[model samples]
Structures are given as structure tokens and as C-alpha cells.
Target: MTAVQGLEGKMMNKYGYGTDYYGYRKKFVVLVPSTNTAVESEYHLMKPTGVALATRACVIPSIKVTNEEEFVGLVKAIGDATEQGLKDALSCEPDHVIFGYSAETFWDGKERSDREFKRYNDIAQAVGGCNITFGAQAIQDALACYPGVKKIAVISPYMPVGDNMVIKFLEDIGYEVTAIKGHCSPGAVEIAHEPFGKTRELVQAVNSADCDLILQAGTNLHFAELAGSLEAELGKPVLAINTITFWHALRTNGIPDRIKGFGSLLSEH
Candidate 1:
């Protein structure tokens, strides 16, 4: 369903809006890369009432790699594959389309990320003939829910260089990104396999007193499980890309701002 319809539908479900004759169900379709198992599950859990969400997996054609050159190529290629996925998603006549993954858009820099996001939309418009949202763009929208949060601490499973790129992007956009902690995994594929238990440990390790909020950067990393609990433990906002992306997509479609038991940010927004 479109964000507006999604929100209205949810409100109607709880408060009863148009009860004339069982109004049409809202449908949201996501195009997720095969490697990204975390996003779909998170979206499903966070999905509001009356929103029927579906996923169409895109072939990776390869596993995640950390080698700089290969990483660059894979990221670009994923965008290409994702465009095709969007085309397929359009076949379902979804109200809106979501890229369903992060990092790929920010592979370059601030300008690069912006360009890539626009590029995705343009490509999707040309191929799928519909508008779509990227994870990075979703984060930007989600941040609006929490005003005056300038200092952010990033937790990631990327290598130091990859981490550096993300920090730079945030800094360019005005966030301090005061601290960062990454395993600098041997490779991107290794990051995909990084144990969720260990990821929780890293998040705990990097969280600091200076930051007002914590951000988990990669969509592929397992983060949904800790979102609610971590916010309660830290007493600070914690936003994972997966969570923020879905939140933004729903918001853009006009979904009401109430999604409880997910995170404090959702509660306050």
C-alpha cells in the first residue's frame, strides 16, 4: 500500500474508519537481495495493521566481499539487479517499492549517495514505471522523527575503510558521528556471517556517553532483535537501517506515526 493508505488503513483497523464493506487491503512490495534476510523479517514485524507486505528476492549472483575493488563492483551490480527486481515487483501493482537494503547507496560519498538514490528512482521509473525508495533515503526521513539529535555513534560490521565511508557521509550531512566501532571483518562475506551474538557485543562496546543516538549502518546485519531492548538499556535512541528504512517508507506513504514495542524513537515519533 502507499504510505498514506498504509497509515490510514492501520488507523482504520484500530479506530474503524471506512467500515462500509471491508475496504481493499493495502499491499507493499519489497525487492530484497538474497543476502539480505534481515530486512524482510524486520519489515514484516514492524508492518502496521491492514498492510499486506510481500517480498521478491533478487539473485546475488555472488556472495558479499570486502576486497575494495570487488566490494565496489558488487555494490554497483546489486543496484543494477535491484532495478530488475523492482520491475518484477511492479507486476504485483504495489502501491510503493522499497530497495530493502542499505550500504549500496552510500558506497561512494555524500554526493555519490545522493546521485545513486536519484539514479535508483530514475531507473525504477524507467523500468518498473513507478517511484521507489532506497534505504539511505529512508534513514534521512526517519531521522526527522527525532529532532535535535546531532551526535550519532555508528556500529557496523564493515572494514575500517568501509566504516570510514559511512562516517564521512554522515559528517558531510552534519551529524558528528563522534565514534565508530567495526569488526573490520576479513571480508564483506565474513560480515554477512558475523554472529548476531558478537554483533550485540560490538554494539555494546561502541556505544558511548557523548552520542545522543546510536545508528546501525548495514541492512544485512541482524539488528531488529536488539532495537527495542537496546533503546531501553541505553536510554538513547537506537536506529538500525532496516528499522528506519521501513519506518520512512511507511511514513512517506502517510502511515501514522505510532508503531509501538519496536524502539523508543518509534514511540516518541
Candidate 2:
């Protein structure tokens, strides 16, 4: 039998003993907007053996974003809903918390993102009694794995307003944006539906010889597998937001399984 099959049988043997799901070594409580459809699916695809992912939704009443103003407003609403989501996730008493949304991670600028992270961190500590991982902090940690990578190309499914915020945060952290391309996707659900072919085209459009790496932002884009493939073609690191977030969560919880075909962040570091 394969290793996974062996593990599965072992877990079944412990069923009568009242162990957690599959004798999971860790549990991650993920919080996402109600309109989001990608985070949970992607997380499930990449989750390693003995790790369980439990998701909670932050309620958002609508997803009809037509303009930059509406887009920004919707992102703010998602952020507002996270408080309730955090409370719900904490009830599960997970080993770690993961913010499964990305647009809000770039709101305002670095200062605002830091304040927001602190708010979420406090909530996780007080209620969940655990540390949390999110896009902004995860990206920062992922970038640190590649030394001397100063110039980067970016691709996202956000409007100009959101793009500016992402750029601001990167600049604040001392990285130069060589090129950036945004899909300007109409709504939350629509962003999740964006074709992987389009993402490939976006990466090609933004790629430059000066760019040390290519980074994809937007939790709904489903770029983890593609990022791994593209890294071979581009001869530089290609990072997806979900990969970074997952890698951060695993590392933070002291798990290092070296997941492959998802990017260097998981496979190498």
C-alpha cells in the first residue's frame, strides 16, 4: 500500500478511540468572504496528509461591483464581516487561523494593513487562542525566502484602487514593482471564475528581464499549480497568494512536508 493508504488505514483503526479526523496533526480554521468560492477549494487541493482545513464564511450581502468605488466598498464590507467569522472559527479551537481573502489585505497601505493584521491577531489570540496567517504577512515571508529579489512583476484580479494598495504595500517594504497587470474583474464570484489561460497571458504581459520574480495576488485566481509550472518557464520564482498563505500556516505550526508541484515556497522552502 502507498504511504497515504497506510495513513488512512491507521486513522480508521483509531476511530473507536475517538481521535480527531484522520488523527490530524494540525487543524487550520480558514475565514473567507461569503462571496468567495476559491479559497476553500484551493486549500483542500493543496492540504497535506494529517492536516485538516475548516472554513468559516464572513458574510457579504452582495457582489455587484461595477466600478472602482464599488469594488473598494465591497472589500471594506468583507473586512467588516471578518470579526464575526473570527469568532465562529475560534469556536473550533483550531491550531492556527488563516485569512482566506486577499483584496482586504492591500487596503489603504502598509500602515493600514499592519493595523488590520494586529486587529485580526488580537481576535485570534483572545478567542481562538492561536496565531493567524494572512496574505500580506504571508507574501512578505515568502519573498524573504528569495534573497536579493528586489524587482517583481505582479498580476491580480483587482481594480485600480486595489492595485494601488498592493503596490503601496510592496513599496513600503522596499521592493520595486517592475510591472503590474490587473484583470479588473467585475465581482467576487467573477474573479473566481477567471480562466487560468487569462492568468498565463497576464504573467507573460508583465514579465520582464529586470523582474526578479513574478507574484500573483488575489486568493480567488487559483494560481498555485500554474505558479509551479511557470517557474520552470520563467526561470524565476512564481508565487501564488494561496501557496504563500498555506506555506506560512504550515511553517508557523512547525510542519515541513515539502509539498511539490505548487511552487518553491512549498517544495523547497
Candidate 3:
């Protein structure tokens, strides 16, 4: 054998990861902010047999975000907490990680998103050599599944600054964001508390006949269950960040189960 092969032969053991009878197919570590209330439950609701999720939360002292500056600060807080969250999650030796925060993923644009994903991925590799799935990349991938989709309408639980970031990111990735709106929830925790009626209204307000798909930002905003119904009514895709990210994680790891009722992104794609 070559020198590389000889060294690899004496390397660390592959611990039979994912041999857990429960997660024998694949194991996922889902990283979310402590302020998030939707990711874990939404992911659990969609998990297939033999797939397991271990959720690790990065605690942020403040969930309050009443303005643009505060929202930016919240993103910084999540960034600082995420590294340690990844380290703690590595204890379980998961096969992959799903980053369940949407704002950071959509902060700058596609290129920036790629760099951030790589930053977290490098951490995963150094510790245990696993991979990670990110929201912007996942949303981009989900949109790619529909080759004909280009015109997009977007809704979020952010103010103008955050929504603008998401819109610019979408455009950078080659989608035409025809219209966009934000629920502008007062605080991080309040993002999940935004009532269903307001979101559905925002969906209609942002959508147009020319729109090909509707996108939702903010993983903490509760929209997974509602996406399917919106699609049924609109005759187009409604891609929520959490659902798309979870779908991306499963598909990236080679889990091919067809999950139903969540929208075409899950059931059909």
C-alpha cells in the first residue's frame, strides 16, 4: 500500500456510527437557537424510519429583537453560540448536522452563505469528519428541484433589513424575487407566536399570478404544516426554511423516503 494508505490503516476506528437500531439508516444533529421553538418539532414530525435527530441548542441571552440593529445583534449572538453547540453535538458523533437557523444562512447572499456553511463544515470535519446541511444552500437546492421555477414571492418574520437580506440572497442565487414581505415580529420568541392568519395573509399579499413559488424565511416561524395547504390553494410551491432544510439534510445523506403532506419539496421531490 502507499504511504497514505498505510497511515490510514492505523487511524482511528469508525465506531460503527449509525448502527443504532433506531437511527440505523442515518443520524442527524440539528443545531438551533434556544429561542427557536419550531425546528425540533417540525423536524420530528417529518422524520422517517431509521433516521434520528439529536437537537443541540445554542443559548442566546436575549430573544428580543424590536428593530434592525437588535436583529443584527441576535445574528451575532447565534454565531458566537453555534461553534460550541457544534462541539457539544459532536459528542454523539452524528453523521451530519442540519443548521436550523435561517437568518445567518441568508445573511449576505449565495457566496457568503457558501462560506459560512464551509466554516461550520470545517469544524465538523476536524472533530469527527461529518458534513453539515445549511438553510440557504438547502433552499437553493430545493428551488433547483423545480427547474421551471424562477419567480419567487417571499415572507418572513423579520423587519425590512432581514427581508432585504433574504431577497438579495435569492437574487444572487438566480431567482427573481417578484415581491417580498415580513411579519416583522417584535422579538425572537415572538416570531413563533405570530398567528397563522397573518402569515396566510402575507402569503396572498406577496404572491402574484406570475410568481412560480412562495418562500418563507425564519425557521422559528411556524409554517411547515401550513405550507402544504398553501400549495394546494395556490398551485405552486411554498418552501419554508425549516422544511427545506430538513429535506435537504435527508436527501444529502441519501435518505430517500417520500414524506407526505408537507408539500412537493418533501413528498414529491
Candidate 4:
């Protein structure tokens, strides 16, 4: 290796100086859509130690939409743009690549988010030859950590079609979705503009005794800010999808479970 490359190798080496370099605490990169905000928020909350993170934004000019046609077109465009963004983010040589946008690819009918995640992973792996995980996979792993959480309620800023896809994706993975409610977000930009207070209300509205856990879906919705508060008030686990996603991401990378102030999910898991 050249001088700079040798230095980089030493910096990234998990066991370079007789120190337990911590397995899984390597470089991570995220391909974020320009209009979305969840990935950065979740990354801050996790405060990954001994790991590096970088991001490349896809060509999402705005998340605002007035009609269905425009929204559909935006979603399709986001998926294509983000895939290309991931190809670029991989150039940083991340140990794992996170596709940090949701609802852009999650659709109803024959298509589903899981299929899209796998497809994205395939592309990322082919280009970068590294491990890959998406926000959905993290949510799935978080659900498994809470064995008693069989039924769940969701609050998101997604349209009905995108909402159905999330519900279906979770159900396909084996959880009983009890209640789900979301703002009629025509696109991701609108979701980003939603006030945090409104999201809290929606979260509490769907929370019920039947539901053991409450999920704040969508990476752009900024649910981690309320997870602990919601959990205290509702007396149940309020899992933000972004929070869970990062929690799982950290775990998959062998990072320790030490994040604080989010909820019992991240710290406890």
C-alpha cells in the first residue's frame, strides 16, 4: 500500500495496536435522499463509537406534492436516483451501506419494500463488495429483540399506498399490526416538514392496550425525538423505525448497545 493507503489501513484496522479495535465498528456510508432527514438524526442518536459514517444525497429536489401523479413519479425517480447515489457513496469504501430513504421505493401490489431492499443490496454489494443493510432490516431485527411485542401500532407521514406497503412488509415478517395511522404525505418532503408535535399526537392516537409496541415508521419523520417520552406516557415500547434501524445496524456491525436517551430499545438491546 502507498503511504496514505497504509495510514488509512492502520486507522481502520480493528486490531492494529494491541487494542480490541471492536469488531463491527468500521466505516459505514448512507445514501440519503436530499429531502429526507431521518438518517442523520438517527445517526446522531446512535453516536456510534469507533465507527465512521458518510453520506451522499440523491437528486431529490423537494418532497412536496399536490397530486397522486406527481407523487408516483417522484417515488420512481427517487429509487433510481438513490441507486446511483449508493454507487457513488460506496467509493468511500464503507464496510456497510445503508439506503437511508423509505416510502420512495415501498409500493403496494406485486411490489414491496423487501424486494426493493434486496435489489438495492444486490447492487450495492456488486459495486462495493461490502455488507449492506437498509432501514427495514434494522426494524425487523428490533422487533425480534422484543419477544413480547407481538402487536404493534404505527405512526408515520406516508400516504395510504406507502402506508399499506409498510404494514404489509412488517406483517410479512411475522408481526401482527394492530393499528396504523399516518399523515397523508403526498411525498417525502412533506413528511420532513411535518411538525414533531403532530407526529407525537398521531403516535399517541394509535397507541392502545392491544398493541404491545408502537412504531414510528419512515426515516424522515423524526420519531426518535419522542420515543422515550412516548414510551413513558403510553407504557409501551415506542420504536422509531430510524432508531431501530440504527440499533440493528450497530448490532450487525458488532457495535455495542450503548446508545442513551432514545428508548429502552437501543440501550437495552
Top-lDDT candidate index? 3
lDDT, candidate 1, equals 0.72
Error of 1 at 113 (Å): 1.8
TM-score of every candidate = 0.82, 0.93, 0.92, 0.84
Q: After aligning candidate 3 to the native by TM-score, how far in Å is the CA of 238 from where it should be?
A: 0.9
Residues 92-168 of candidate 2 have per-residue lDDT tens digits of: 78888999988898777778888999998998998878989978988899999999799999999988888888899
TM-score of 3: 0.92
lDDT of 2 at 176: 98
Angstrom error of the Cα, residue 139, model 1: value is 1.5
Taking the tens digit of each residue's C-alpha lDDT, what string does model 4 give over 1-269? Answer: 24455456667875666322332247777778888776786676676556666867887777566666666666777877877788888887777877676665446522456677788789777998886777676677788888887888888776666678778877777888898888877666667777877887787688777999988777777778689777877778888877776676677877775777888888788
In terms of TM-score, the best-performing candidate is 2
Clashes of each: 8, 0, 0, 2
After superposition, candidate 3 runs with Cα above 4 Å error: 1-18
39-68 per-residue lDDT for model 1 (tens digits)? 777787787666667788766765546566
| Candidate 3 residue-wise lDDT, 56-128, digit = tens | 8998875678889998988889988999998899889899999989898888888888998899899999996
lDDT of 1 at 150: 93
Number of clashes found in candidate 2: 0
